[model samples]
Target: MCNAEIDPKTVPHMRELMAGLPTNWGKWGPDDEIGCLNYLTQAEVLRGVASIRSGKTFTLQVQMGNPKGDPVWPGRRGAQRINLMDKGDFICGNGPQTPGCHEFADDLMIMYLQGSTQYDALGHVWYDDHIYNGFDAKSTAGGMQKASVLPIAERGVVGRGILIDMARHRGKDVLDRGETFNHHDLIDAAKAQGIEIEKRDILLVRTGWIGSFYRRDPAEFYTDFVEPGLTFSRELVDWFKEMEIPNLVTDTIANEVTLEPETGVMIPLHCALMRNLGVAFTEIAALDALAADCAQDAQWSFLYTAAPLKVVNGSGAPVNPLVIK
Candidate 1:
């Protein structure tokens, strides 16, 4: 549906962009309103086809934090928090004294996205007055549902994947926090890795920042100037927008720029990626092992699966994402 009050010239390529999205089984009305058909007869057929394809799937887990360990943070104290606790307790009982089983239990704080490796939907963030899928930021404060909200459940992300080792590109075993990664650096890494990004692909970035924080002092890791993160640049945003990628995952604290000195702001990439383009993001993914495996096999795509907790209007969820190659 087109907005009559809004100037069509404002978004000269709006039609082209809309064409790129999947088919809409709904109707458009005046005032830019959309109404969906209650139940489509063809929906079941399409779902059956999808289920058939999903039967032969592979998966890999990309979580890093141990349940018995402390949570992973950026600062020195934060670093120590990871795996600080020991294996705690177990509840064992017998079923009518016939058999006994023990369930090991511990207070767990996981740092990875979606309980493990995961993706952040475009509805996760907003900028100015715009959100993912071109939703109005004002109307979203109350928490929009489905398309307006981050549809982590609806959009099953199964596609090609690419990993760019930014740390290796910079000739460092690991990167510290506050380390800036520019758009050019990303481009160079892609070139060096000999990977060509394709539309609807999942892009994975390995900054090595996770490794540094995992091994270094929390204070130093958080305050250090060598931690790798995606730097905010118009060019980078433009690149992703032009590429029309679907999802992005990274082995960093956040998927985008953090703590800009000049602007004193964090999450510049958040606004660009989540707000402008409807691209999903995931952070703190355990990618080192996966990256190593990929490097050996020269393969990137895998059966990637992540399911978030069903929390109402939650800003984020702890996920345990696994990739099966």
Candidate 2:
């Protein structure tokens, strides 16, 4: 979400100002795929690992299939499907078990590459004809030739994760759909949590919308739920760059409140972070459990690791991110 209530004038003016957007485009080199992941240095990883105390782990991905109804994203396939395989299947499965072996069960999962918790590849977003580093969008016509998920999947991301529970800070069960959190909101929330966000840390914002939607009422969840997410401002963009955060995960799709388009770029956060800043982002994560745990335990930070599927030219993939303390 571009600053809540961006003047219609600002919308039209954004294009001309686009040249000034923050970018790590050439900073990571000409052949950079895993953009900000470079921030996950050896020292940072070791520090994150050292931070672990309780050794309890949390699953950051929501179930692949959710709500038990229509697909979350209309354009893409829905959820996960399991099909009993007869040896060779189009998509590989763990199944086609030994014949007559009831004790052993094997089946293949027809996974929707990105149905639930997932990261956005650096090549995922584009503005008109260009992508990150000013690469022609057509150059990645059939597949992501630049900034594919391959490098991220191979290298993996392990670092400190800081959570900003916006809902609790806001003193509400959840931020209503179309509600937004901006730079000041984040700073204020962090202050309330009594924690400081650090460099190379994975940032996770808990809007509480996901918990409200799934646990309370799916109807209310989908209805008028434009999306309660982050609102991006110039300052927020600069913060991402300044903090050097590698991955930004949120509990909603788009990671920004879905706004009614008045003009150019619809998902401005994606364009700015993915294309210009080369910062990877994950969406639709399950944070309720972790949020509750954080509140009760008063431990908001933890060691984090997210390894996306190593699909050759995958733009992004559904993943099970693990957070341990």
Point to the candidate with the largest TM-score. 2
Q: Looking at model 1, report the run of 10 residues with the lowest lDDT sum.
A: 31-40
What does the lDDT come to for candidate 1?
0.52
> Please, what is the TM-score per model?
0.64, 0.86
Deviation in Å, model 2, residue 150 alpha carbon: 1.5
Error of 1 at 281 (Å): 1.0
lDDT of each prediction vs. the true structure? Answer: 0.52, 0.77
For candidate 2, the per-residue lDDT at 67 reads: 42
Off by over 4 Å in 1: 1-118, 134-150, 224-227, 261-263, 301-303
lDDT of 2 by residue, 1-325 (tens): 3353656665654455455767887887887778888999998898789878899999988776554532254355556556455445423654544467443435565655667788777788776677777777876779888777777888898898989999999898788768877867887888888888877788899998666656665566566547877766777789889989888899877788776233433577888777888888888788988888888888888899889888877888878899998
Worst 10 residues of 2 by lDDT: 66-75
Which lDDT value does model 2 have at 216? 62
